[model samples]
Target: MERTLVMGILNITPDSFADGGKFFSFENAIERAKEMISEGVDIIDVGGESTRPGAARVTEQEEIERVVPVVTELVSIGANVSIDTMRSKTAEAAIGAGAKYVNDVSGGLADEKMAKLISRNPNVQYVCMHWRGHSNQMQLKAEYEDVVKDVKKELDERVAQLLKSKVSSDQIILELA
Candidate 1:
């Protein structure tokens, strides 16, 4: 049987769905990453934005500032890190800071540059999730003839775009969550 790799979640924002405000501080976030590493986590997903319903949108600069430091610190400590963000700028900063992956919940809908960015960074893994829109109004946009078929179709289209942009299949990680 194939072993399932564990990816630890590190929310550095004050309004995440769960564990918000728990590791909002840089020091706290680092500690949590360390703990996860010690507990055998294969990857650490660091997020700076809160995508809950009605959550406020953070500026790109704010997201960059909130995540780069933590990502840098985590990578320095030898933890495999992934940046949980949708914006290309944020993903670039995180990759520059040593993150190995981009976990974009918007599936590239939120940022036009995302697919191209992932394509450019051929070594970085890209996690594209099933998303209709941003969290603030995604639920309202969830209409579909067949949920399963529609989601697969959407993801396939996004994947095709990524491929056209030169992203390798090995570097793409589809996220159903």
Candidate 2:
């Protein structure tokens, strides 16, 4: 039987939906990551910005400032790190800082450069989610004729676009959220 990898979420933001303010500090986040690793997590996904409904957008610089340090610390401890971000610049910085994956919730729709980033980084893992827009306005786009079929169709189109951009199939991860 194939084994499944359990990924742990480490949100380093002050306003995330579930664990806001708990791991907002770098030290706290690192501690949480260590705990997760001890608990058998295979991957640690670090999110600098909150995607909660109506949350304001975080600038690339701010995201980098929040994420890179955490990624760096995690990597130094031999953790497999994933950066949860929508901006290509932030993703680049996190990768440079030692993150191996990008968990992009926008599915390359929020930023055009996202696909190109994945294409350029052949070894970097990319997660493409089924998202219509940013959290602030995503609720307005929740309508779907057939939820499952529509999501599958949309993911297929996005995956095709990524393949066209020279991103390998193995590098892509799909989320039907």
Candidate number of the best TM-score = 2
The Cα local distance difference test for each model comes to: 0.91, 0.92
On residues 41-113, what C-alpha lDDT tens digit does candidate 1 reach at each position? 9999999999888788999999999999999998888889999998999999999999999999998889999
TM-scores, each model vs. reference: 0.96, 0.97
Q: Report how far off residue 140 is in candidate 1 (Å).
A: 0.5
> Which residue pairs in candidate 1 collide?
none
Q: Candidate 2 on 31-79: residue-level lDDT in tens?
A: 9999999999999999998998899988889989999999999999999
The total of clashing pairs for model 2 equals 0
Off by over 4 Å in 1: none
